[model samples]
Target: MRHQKHIIAVFGGREADQKLLEEAEHFGQLAAEAGWIIICGGKGGIMEAVCRGVDAKGGISVGLLPEAKDIEANEYVGIPLATGLGYARNEVLALACHAACAFGGKYGTLSEIAHALNNQKPVAAVESWKIQGVHECNHAWEAFEWIQTQLK
Candidate 1:
């Protein structure tokens, strides 16, 4: 039985620098082209970048907003959900994704990575944390390749 949610959680820093933001967007475009739905904690920075790419490709994206109790409409996001779970939403993101792709991030991204690993979901990373279990990639293509293989 092939158990696939076909959802890939993208975790990254809200304060990500320009390079990381660009990489995340490119990754999103590639992933969307592969027909995978992108999910991320809703806000700005990396999340918004990914949304832009997804929107460009007419691909679907789900945003889990931590602060909002009601779904806030976003032009880029196909589905905007208000979790009201705050940082706890990371746990939901982990459970909902088949795999994860992480770019440069801070503590929140670290937590999402940890949760995905804990759920036994494979994680492909780019310039993210150097945790032992993370499959680190030099760039988005490498990470996307690894992610595709894992999903398969």
Candidate 2:
């Protein structure tokens, strides 16, 4: 039997700072190198950064957009899924992936984390939230490592 590629959802702020964006980009690159597909919110900031990294490494990126318009997705998104569910799309994002990772974010990111946990998906956080049951890491690489273990 052929093994399926793992899908990892990366959640973060749409208006994240440059440092956070860089970290997210590196996280996406590492995930791609590990042969995992990246899923994200499909907008700007961390989403765009991660998608760009995935594109740079020739990895596929799936974008879950809250809007119905395909133009809402970032340029690097290889696959744009327009849900038109707004914040409710978080449920789809959580359920669609094998695991999830959260960078520094706002309410939207928090919602994604909650949805993932509620769906029984393992989640790793990098300088993000401090909720119980969520693996916390100091860096994106650490978070990816934890996610890799969880996928096993």
Candidate 3:
């Protein structure tokens, strides 16, 4: 049988500081090196940074767009899904991932985390929310390490 590829949902705010962006990118590269697939909201900030990092590693990254326009996705997104589901698309993002990671974010990120947790998917958060069931990490590498173990 062929090996199954793990899909990682990367969630975060549309707006971010330089530090968060760097962390997200670093995590993306790590994930890419592990031969995992990255999925994100397909906008700017953290999403773009993660995609950019994965792109640099020659990995596949997908963008789930809130709008119907594929052009709305960040330039680094290799495959853009024009879902037009707005916030409702978070459900798809949550359900599709084998594991998930979050950088600093707002309610949207929280919502995605909730959906993933409810579905019994492991979530590793990097400087993100301190939810009851989440594996909290201080840095991107920590988050990557935690999720990698969860998948095993």
Indicate which candidate wins on TM-score: 3
Candidate 1 minimal-lDDT segment of 10 residues: 67-76
* Clashing residue pairs in candidate 2 (N, C-alpha, C atoms within 3 angstroms): none
lDDT of each residue in 66-119, candidate 2, tens digit only:
998878799999899998889998889899999999999989999999999999
Supply the global lDDT for candidate 2: 0.91
Candidate 2 residue spans exceeding 4 A from truth = none
- Candidate 3 ranges with C-alpha deviation above 4 Å: none
User: Candidate 3's residue-wise lDDT over 71-151, tens digit each?
Assistant: 878999999999989999999999999999999999999999999999999998887889999998989999999999999
Which scores higher on lDDT, 1 or 3?
Answer: 3
Question: How does each model score on lDDT?
Answer: 0.87, 0.91, 0.94
For each candidate in turn, the TM-score is 0.93, 0.96, 0.98
**Model 1: per-residue lDDT, tens digit, 1-152?**
98554899999877888888889889889878988899998678888888888888888899998876544434577789987788999999999999999988999999999999999999988999999889999988899999888876
Worst 10-residue lDDT window for candidate 3 reads 124-133
How many collisions between residues are there in candidate 3? 0
| Count of residue pairs whose backbone atoms collide, per candidate | 0, 0, 0
What's the CA error at residue 83 for candidate 1, in Å?
A: 1.1
State which candidate, 1 or 3, has the greater TM-score: 3
**Model 3, 55: alpha-carbon shift in Å?**
0.4
